[model samples]
Target: MAAPAATAAPSVPPSLSLPPSQFARIQPHAYLLAHLSPPSASNQPSIRANGRAPSQFRVTSANAGSLTHTNGSAVVRIGDTAAVCGVRAELLHTEDIASWSVSQASSSNKRRRLADLGEKPTEEDEDEDPEDDRAHIEDLNLLVPNISLSTGCAPGFIPGAAPSALAQSLSHQILSLLHSTRLVRADDLRVWYQQPNLGPEEPERHNENEQMDVDAEQSATIEDKPREIKAFWVLHIDIMIISLAGNPFDAAWAAVLAALRDTKLPKAWWDVDNETIVCSDSVSDARKLSLRGLPVASSFGVFEADAAAGWRANVIPDATEQTQTGKKGSPERWILADPDGYEEGLIQERACIVVDKQKDGKTTIVKMEKNGGWTVDTEDLRQLVEISAQRWDEMKRILDQC
Candidate 1:
């Protein structure tokens, strides 16, 4: 008998509901132009959908500790975009955890050695860590975050299928921010417990000046070590896409931050006789998770609209010229905050900034990501910083209230 014929895959991508030609890119300005534009010759928009200015954010609502079963939970809504985040704390045995620094160091060294053999670390592993001392290395696998874009949340998602590329990419970005920013320190999660060394810690040389009986002296030489462990707490962060209007990053991050603020670990104690750990059930005995910094992220979309620029080239502009300059760009360049699904569709560029305020009241940028083939200069960066600073403060207040 001949071998079975191979099955061919579908030609059309599952992500597309209809053929590409059927979709027409319609921006917010297209619908809001009349309402937003000045009555003069310039029909340029000063407002977007629902009367929102470029830098203005949609109304936001947040609720924390909504899930009783979870260690912590929060629901965040920004305009139509919504996200529900739940954090679960689980116990891990010391033997099961590995030092991340050690593994990464070894991996880098091996790559470099391979580079010397035939490849080069400079080319392949420039962004990778060169090497590090493993003696004091700490394990950082304590926190894990997973984002899901369910079929119910979006049109492109398929039920019960492998994670979509968007979900995977978002998850990776979240994990990277957690690691690169050092927002949550491994030292905070570590459960400290020490074991006793029954044998003599020092040399058993005879002491001529000893006064006690031989057996009594030997027994009294040392005390039993305290019961403890060098273990750490593991966090499972699951964020569900409740509703995605746009700007999932900001909504999801808000949910996560709020949920973490609500997290509390049960008080645990070592049971020497049973050789296990025991946790207290009383709520008062619980301890709050140590957080290094409260970081907030904001995303902006840059749309390349054709604004009128006749006055822009002139050395001087009279009243008429200055007046006409306002009408220069139609669908002109606009920097939108918290873009919705429709605006996101027409965006030519995107940028995200994560920041937190220090004890001295100064804002600090933790991480920044830019993508989508947009060009940005120093002035754009400055604007981003200003916007992020305001949003970061607002977020901190909201989390506090929650």
Candidate 2:
């Protein structure tokens, strides 16, 4: 006669509305719309009682080097959502299309000068195809939002499928954003293919007595060339939703920045004489991508009823209590920052706004998408830009800690 186990409380049936299948289509968004909004300050978690607000974000943690084989890797956990990013690099030759770019010209001149200075043409170069002797160019690829939905996160999987469509879309969005922005460069990460045709009596071979002079001359030529500019690097980022708390866009952006901060690219060697490629394995020789600064996201909830009144919306960096409460929730709607899962179900309408600030102090709204029913006016858009710019510098400083 075993005692009966205590029964758990009955839970609400999972709603079929807005299923994962549909989410996959929109997850790549720059700003994920979160519908969760506290009915009032009193309805939020205890943290709000401790002076925290309903829109406040949870502690975000970042770590790197989880995977050793990848060129570079990093992980960021914002509350329950966790994302990992890995960087891999490959060396490629300059395409025939852009054979005369600045990189090609500079590398070509260096190699020719090296040959003239009497350094023995390495054996590798001796075996190179005469046609392949032309200058080399390199390109970079970055893969992101490789979604891995851990069992610990949710039971929203579509049986017999890999990642949901939402996951793929998110990954693609991040990769596209990173690539179009030129945040990394592949040309600089080239690893020379060490040509194998240099003969002992090659024209560039230096006599023993002239070895020191040749070395000096080659060094001088290399010194004359300006360092290569790396527009962006290829990276693979895997984002796992450990908790579907809501606002995937903001969490993803934070994760992307964290992954990039720790990502490293291999060092490259150029066959300056032949405008060729060379990659290095030594960490000391590798380079890092120069990010344009953090691009944070904000979202607004427009009530379906507010369509007639014209729902006002803007993206701001540092919002004050006055600004936040400038408009109250009507039967129509409201805009909020970083909404969580529960609030989404409660709201009738929503929209997301994202901003990226250039080094010159100009802010660009890279993304805007909304659901439910509301339209924004120019005056509201202008206010959002001002708010985003004001907070850009400060947000960057905090995000730099990652």
Candidate 3:
């Protein structure tokens, strides 16, 4: 009876303890905000939940020629987001294109008129006519890019499912950028054939005059027949999301850029005997694509401090209190670079800047897209562009090494 009287109940701690992972899972917004806006007295630099500075980007690594079967292939990883891209070149004969003849004739007539005017077309002229290049690629569908996100790469993406909206949107974005940048030149994709000039039969004459006349006729006949485009190399660009933590566009585009840079198209020619195009089997005869510029993409997210739960909200002074005290308050908003999945869910505003650095140390903005919120302004865009320039350099160096 005495032994059963007192097995003193073990004392329990006042509060329950939770692992960081569990805490993050339970209160994602508050967890991220706590890291981003630590106490002023803690003397800690503001960092993201992933332990990166507000403007810090994840480490990027790339590998080219990863797929031996494809004409060109690359694998790129930016932190947890990974993508693989493969480029396959297929021949599209002029006969297969219903409008090829019409387009070619129109272009030839235009060139002839220009020649008659004694105005030779220059590089600057082509630059001014950007739509010509765009039309060629878009009309012919020379560059076919498709993205797949049904590989169970991330949450909500079931395996073997239909292509999701994200996949469709990404594919469209890639296609638009390809047309706008004119990255791949049509001339490079064209395979030409010189038609044999059959001149009118001339009476046989045993005189030098007759021989000269024959030569003149041959020259005229040859001049009349120009090299014709027999076929074009249609590039099929396929991208697969291996792992998608967040910021998919950047990773996907980087993979495509790397794969295109590593891509080597076989030297092809129109075989007169076979009456078809033939490609050289030797690797030495292959050639790389002449990409126009090294355009790189950088993504960002805007996190509002007030978006977190009230239990863990930071102590932001009221506007009236600040005005009365005449003391400035810290900013309650933050711009995060390369946000991960957790941060992405809580962030409503986002921006992406595609930048290419020129040889003169100037940055050119290929594309600038922002949506979901209006907190980001022109000055913020300028700053983002600068960050994109740095990212461009980093991407260029990685691709060059690959």
Candidate 4:
């Protein structure tokens, strides 16, 4: 048999395997798209790489008054993103401000005129002249909001480094929203004192025969001295991002809202003898801030299914089915709510809706910010608003419990 025919070497089929994590790391776009747009034969509902539905948000939790040192403090977490916010109240004397006198004079005159007209200032009036209503807060910079994200909260963020551009941008956005919403009332921050009127130099009425009774009667008839602003409580809102997975703005804003709601400034009064403001030490004397409305932020990202279409076309041998279905030319898109870090990296288009639902069952859109893509339209905005309303309800309930 001629050396016993050499047995054909057994052939081993080519094989390769990779863990899900390794696959995601190597092919992020493909990995996400695979979940978002599964094969037609699978008949699976579209979902995100993080195992959440397109419109689903991560669970949120908040805890107020967590820090004892700060006047108001809150810890908030939305999924893996977590933040701590503190509100510290400091007194700013009117005498220290150069423009306080001028602004106070103008404001007093306007108030007197409004009083004379016998018409109380209405929301419509304030809306017509928002700049005037916001003058004190903006001009004085009473509300100082700063966001810190340099504590190695995420990759590329080195601890102890200077604030990154993202941090500055978030700070600006928070400050802008605070001013636009007028969430904190200026009246609550004002510390007023009545001026003592020394009526026309009474010349020391020590003698009983000097018509002391007549002078007393006349003084009683005189109108009360106008109350002047002695000082204002400046709120320094500091937010620190402990962990950032994505959707940082929403977490930051929620922490701010919760902390502000928990904030209670001490009752303060002007001390003439010391020529300074005095704050009550008793806990019972602390007063909480009167926030105008609960404005909640909801952010979404738009991911085009065709982000890697070109790569797929190059890799796949056949394009006949894709061309016939027209999917190759026009791929579908998804609006992902509360996108995580992985999803945020793959998405470019985004929209943020800030809404406040009133006690009267009316929902008000406080602000809407969108950028990067035109895939979202008016109908999409309406749907986002509905989603935001539900989010607002959830946040409200959590905050109330806190």
lDDT of 1 at 67: 94
Per-residue lDDT of model 1, residues 83-159, tens digit only:
99999988776656565446546665786687579964442233223232112122446678999986778776768
Q: Please give, for residues 197-242, the per-residue lDDT of candidate 4 as tens digits.
A: 6564466776786767767766875553456779888999999999
Which residue segments of model 2 deviate by more than 4 Å? 1-55, 91-145, 158-160, 186-233, 270-278, 303-331, 358-372, 386-395
Candidate 3 Cα errors over 4 Å, as ranges: 1-10, 120-131, 196-206, 308-331
Q: What's the lDDT for candidate 1? A: 0.71
How close is every model to the real structure, measured as TM-score? 0.70, 0.55, 0.88, 0.84
Clashing pairs for model 4 are none
Q: How are the candidates ranked when ordered by lDDT, highest leading?
A: 4, 3, 1, 2
Which pairs of residues collide in candidate 3? none
lDDT of 4 at 185: 82
Selected candidate, larger TM-score, 1 vs 4: 4
Candidates arranged by TM-score, highest first: 3, 4, 1, 2
lDDT of 2 by residue, 334-373 (tens): 3444455544544555655667787687778766666664
Answer with 2 or 4, whichever has the higher TM-score: 4
Output the lDDT of residue 152, model 1.
Answer: 74
